[model samples]
Target chain A: MAVAEIKIELKKGVADPEGQNTKKALELLGFEGLRSVRSMKCFQVDIGLEGDEALKACQDMCRRLLANPVIQSYSVELK
Target chain B: MAVAEIKIELKKGVADPEGQNTKKALELLGFEGLRSVRSMKCFQVDIGLEGDEALKACQDMCRRLLANPVIQSYSVELK
Candidate 1:
């Protein structure tokens, strides 16, 4: 069995409103002295196969869906 | 300076509509035999400080916003 670990790395300037809102909430809750926050998404899927073939399939997912290639980069670990 | 790495892991049955839609697109585009797909989000931030202090701040961010603790688990690595 092939396990695909998909990790998406978003650009620093992508305007993460969710992250920004979180920061404000944190400040209000007395988490003072905290400077910044960012968020990323990860996916682990079972490819039910092996090797480069599985890699290609997952990469396709990254390109077409898992991430916006224009704004993010993806790394895949096949285990 | 403190570097905070934010990772969000969503539940397996969280109804990833985006993922499902991606799967369909992949099949239509000729990539066959793909059974399932899942996705996650990650973030890396410079906390402008150091040590356990930063970890606590980031964890606060997770509890308040980075993740919906009811449906997700967050892990933080302070570097």
Candidate 2:
């Protein structure tokens, strides 16, 4: 079997409201010296196959549905 | 400075609608051999501290805000 770990995150300069909110909340909760916080999405897909074929399938899945290429970027690691 | 990577994921037996939906969509799009899909939240936080102190702060953050103790589990890696 092949397992793919995909991480989808906003592109640089993209506004991340959830991240901003989290930072604010942390500050309010008295967490100190916080520089920044970024929040993103993660997906792990287990495929009943192996090798490049599994990698290719995961990339296609990301392009089609897992990410919005216009505002987000994604990386896939296969194991 | 310290960088903490936090990953929050649904515990086993927890319902994952997003993962389920992604799996179904992949199947509909004709991607084969998909065994399972799991989705999660990733947070990268930069703190103005280092070492064990930073790690402890991150663990506190996770317990206080980043994750829910009931259905989700979180792990933090600090560097």
Q: What C-alpha lDDT, on a 0 to 100 scale, does residue A55 get in candidate 1? A: 91
Write model 1 residue lDDT over A1-79, tens digit each, in one string. Answer: 7888888876767887766776677678777665676656777777777999889888887887668977888889997
Q: lDDT tens string, model 2, A5-52?
A: 999999999999999999999999999889999999999999887889
On residues B1-79, what C-alpha lDDT tens digit does candidate 1 reach at each position? 8888887777766787766776677678777776776656777767766788788777877787668987888788877
| Share of native interface contacts recovered by each model | 0.74, 0.94
> In model 2, what are the clashing residue pairs, if there are any?
none
The lDDT, on a scale of 0 to 1, for candidate 1 is: 0.76
Model 2 CA RMSD to the hidden true structure, in angstroms: 1.1
Tell me the whole-model lDDT of each prediction, alpha carbons only: 0.76, 0.92
Q: What DockQ values do the models have?
A: 0.56, 0.87
In model 2, the Cα lDDT at residue B5 comes to: 90
Worst 10 residues of 1 chain B by lDDT: B31-40
